[model samples]
Target: MVHKFAIEQGALIEQLPEFIQSHFNMVIDVKADGPCGYHVVAHSLGRGEELEFYSKEYTFSNIHQTLGSIYPTPSEPVGTKHWMSMPSMVEAIANAFESPVFFFSPNLFSIMLPSLLSAQSNSRNIYCISTKYTPFCVLNDEPYEFPAPRYLKNWEKSATKEALGWAQLYSPNFQKAHD
Candidate 1:
């Protein structure tokens, strides 16, 4: 849905990796108010921009921890406004949906799931890209996707070790590759 907080995504579209540009057509800007990462997932699922994992009883599984190691408190409680929810909420959704969730940041990314083997067989996978504000872009293609990136951004190129560390936080799979 169109809104004031959506990203313009003009020239930035051209700068995307050739693989991404080839796989999906750039859609309209997703509202950047807050939970835009969730929005992308919902869209990928063909459910439009609505993700309602909260306001239900099942989403509170071991989620009383910090977000990304810096936030003082845990993610917001249920029934909060759409734009007020945090990105980590996707963790609960991924668990509930029994799928893997990818946190795609500017220079780093993370693959989070309860079990790598189980998530690999999941029918529904999630990808969220953290932009300057929130996750505004969604990559929803298969076959062309690779585990280790052939080309990374300038920031990631200089810090491959650091980037792999960020990925290892959620998946021991990264540990094997790094080792």
Candidate 2:
């Protein structure tokens, strides 16, 4: 369902950057009900299972085993603070696919600061994206709220460069260790 706020409020989308606007055309509608995050990740990894089945099979069934297997060392633990219980799920997905998980969030540096900071520093292939207009959630059934950065709205300034700088600094280090 499209977020109600996005449809009712034209100003939000109208003020977004051109690049973000262009990307909007390709939006894929995922089922909002149930574990949408898991569904999206599973879909991305080519896992055709539904949310419930995937959660039960991959997450609940063997989360501790998965975590122990990946992060056997005590120095580097596996889990997320803000996203409690999600670290295990993430670890399971990453281990299952043998690929890194990249989480893109507009508020990664802000709202997700605790989780980001407390995340396993040595978790390989887990890239984080902090940028403007990051889709957060569906507000009442209009479209996903793609709120422009506050700096953009107030000063007509784009934080893309700063965001990219942060990503560049962190991503390379994360990838280097893994590679």
Candidate 3:
């Protein structure tokens, strides 16, 4: 069976694509904390949102790797939380979990954010999530139960390399992490 990557709703809800908005009525909402994205990741992983410092470190490194030319690539401080998000955070979550993430954002499909799916690195592998044309909010189980508003049931399939294949199928730039 095919598994999905579910995001906790805040700003992402408004952005769901036609494919998802028509099929599923579920929408999970993580706490409105600084690390809500992390919360979504943690929830999917069957753990709490509190993670290691490497998560922050990994996120920043990817940002530099991907966008260093366009933005100031200094090692200066960056925040842990997000208003909506900063790029490569998805990549960070993918690395931290050792799982493949899937994006539900329409931006990638529309080319609003072209490199939105790029792994942001051409050198070493970055095991970030994949991109979907439609929208955000999804994942699987040891019978992992999603949070309120949906309480969706899924399995822990996203953690495997197989899930990575699924992500790659939908994600255009997934090769950056592999190739």
The better candidate by lDDT, 2 or 3, is 3
RMSD for each of the candidates: 9.9, 14.3, 13.7
Q: After superposition, how far is residue 99 of candidate 2 from its true place, in Å?
A: 2.0
lDDT of every predicted structure (CA atoms): 0.46, 0.34, 0.35
Error of 1 at 55 (Å): 9.1
Per-residue C-alpha lDDT of model 3 across residues 79-101, encoded as one tens digit per residue: 44323263345544555545444
Using TM-score, give the best candidate's number.
Answer: 1
How does model 2 score by TM-score?
Answer: 0.31
Runs in model 3 deviating more than 4 A are 1-14, 22-25, 48-86, 109-179
- Candidate numbers, best TM-score first, in rank order: 1, 3, 2
lDDT of 2 by residue, 28-49 (tens): 2233333334444544444432
TM-scores, in order shown?
A: 0.48, 0.31, 0.36
Clashes in candidate 1: how many? 0
Q: Per-residue alpha-carbon lDDT of model 1 for 1-179, expressed as tens digits?
A: 53444445544344454434444444445656454554566665556664343223235444423222222223442333434233556555555555556555556555545332232332555666655654455556552233523222342344334233333333344333344
